[model samples]
Target: MSTKILICIDFSPLTPRIVKTGKELAKALNLGVHLVHAQPEKPSAPTAVVHQGADPSLGREMMKEIKELNNLKSDFEEEDIPCSYATPRGKTSDVIAAEAAKVEAPYIVLGSHGNGAMYHLVVGSVAEGVMKKLDTPVILVPAQQRLDREAGR
Candidate 1:
């Protein structure tokens, strides 16, 4: 029985390294990856109106996620890893924690910067926010290290 893993993806530039690390780890453990994104939230009263009509906003969020998911899948499809994507709307941290709990994933993964636009998660040490709250182990990619590795600094 392979373990299930969830990674919070935001499709930012830092995503490639995060995906690479995640794929490597998942392959090592024979685990499947659940790529998740917490969609940007608009106020309920206003957005709900846009959602109520035939123009339901469900597709709006999921559509972009689906494309990004395919990109992630293709990125490692040659490696024979099983990967999928999902999006559930809610507060950022709450959504990630809830999704991880729902899947009972043995590990939860996220990039240095999650949905929080305030600051870098590890740089500002906000990665602890998820790691501390999540029962499952959380893997945070130190993307800043990439610059150092590239520049040979």
Candidate 2:
């Protein structure tokens, strides 16, 4: 089986940078890419009323994320890198780590905006949470640092 890298993406302005970084690493490491988006769980949201045996709201949300995943996967494909995508719903870190483990990923890549470090002290950061949960190597590219690196490249 081919080894893969799990890339956790949020639909942030830093997404392109994250994808570029992941692609570069995957190329260097000779591993395929597995892109995963962890949709934050909304505990307060009520279940959508069943209409014709379908939850319209849930379907809309899934469609949105799947579209984003396809777009991201296309980027990897353009680089000639084998890639797959998934959008899992739940606690961001848990979902990401679980997906990584399921795919037997050897590495995980993600972007972090340390601007929220203070807030994370109260609520916890997805990056930090993932670090705590998984034994796999994680590469966290801080958003600001990524901007600098991209500019220099």
Q: Over the full model, what C-alpha lDDT does candidate 2 score relative to the true structure?
A: 0.81
**C-alpha lDDT score of every prediction, in listed order:** 0.71, 0.81
**Residue pairs with backbone overlap in model 2:** none
Once fitted onto the true fold, the runs of candidate 1 whose alpha carbons sit more than 4 angstroms away are: 43-62, 74-78, 114-126, 145-152
lDDT of 2 at 152: 100
lDDT (tens digit, per residue) of candidate 1 on 20-108: 77887889888888777876565533466666643455566567667878888776566777776676767677777777777778988
- Output the worst ten-in-a-row residue range by lDDT, candidate 1: 114-123
lDDT for each residue of candidate 2 in 73-123, tens digit (9 for 90 to 100): 887888888999887779888998888888889889998876555797788
Number of backbone clashes in candidate 1:
0
